[model samples]
Target: MTATRAPQGQEETRAGLWARLGDRLIVGGATVGDHGRDGEIVGLHHGDGTPPYDVRWSDTGRVTLVFPGPDARVQHFAPHAGPSAVRQS
Candidate 1:
């Protein structure tokens, strides 16, 4: 078996991934012939990254509200200048 990293960002524990405003969501399987979609969280309806996020798609360049499923995973980005506590396990 091979390992795969989340596209465009790093994959950390789900604890630190509350679907932050600027974080990205990577969905689908990590293998060949996999279809996945990703986008940035622009708006948070619940104020937290719980669900129903407004995402701007990289492929379509459009913003849409999303309720991510179980197949979805989050990829968090680092701040401009700060120590990141998002460690990979």
Candidate 2:
């Protein structure tokens, strides 16, 4: 899965970036040996897939609100991305 990320050492995120339900989030670890963590975007607090997303972690199955940092990347696969895809908050 391809991801649009800032330059190798750059910290800023690409413009117009957002996520939705069913999207996969991969967060990089501090070191290369660490595989880091991944999760599914199960809830959208603003219904717009903005920050502070409710994520269900694949490793722990724990759901938590996430504010993605520079180390985090999202892989979206929302075919029907629009009003119908948004859930009532």
Candidate 3:
């Protein structure tokens, strides 16, 4: 998986990025070693899978945007699959 970022690491996100609905967002990329946040893509602000995705956090059930950041990456799982298996992108 590649990291998307604004030019010079600015806090801007470009539109048209593809994100599947229900995909998981893994924060910290294992650098935090299992303590990072885990969230699911619940909705999209844009229909075309753009940034600022609506994410429902697993640990807290808090819904928030999966904003552009260096510490986050997306993990996609097969449809109807159980939580035991996770397909990372």
- Top candidate on lDDT is 2
Which scores greater on TM-score, model 1 or model 2? 2
Candidate 1 off by > 4 Å: 1-17, 29-32, 79-89
Better by TM-score, candidate 3 or 2 = 2
List TM-score per model, in order.
Answer: 0.62, 0.67, 0.58
Candidate 3 TM-score, C-alpha based: 0.58
Which sequence of candidate numbers ranks them by lDDT, best first? 2, 1, 3
- Locate the minimum summed-lDDT window of 10 residues in model 2: 77-86
Model 1 error, position 75 (Å)? 0.6
Q: Put down candidate 2 lDDT per residue, 1-89, tens digits, no spaces.
A: 99777665343544754786777889998897999999988888776557878888989999998998989988765444533465678
Q: lDDT tens string, model 3, 1-89?
A: 99865675232444434465777877764654567888888888877666788988899999986675776777655555434455467
Which should have the higher lDDT, number 1 or number 3?
1
lDDT tens readout by residue for model 1, 25-76: 7777567787878877778888645788888887798999887878888676
Backbone collision count in every prediction? 0, 0, 0
- Candidates ranked by TM-score: 2, 1, 3
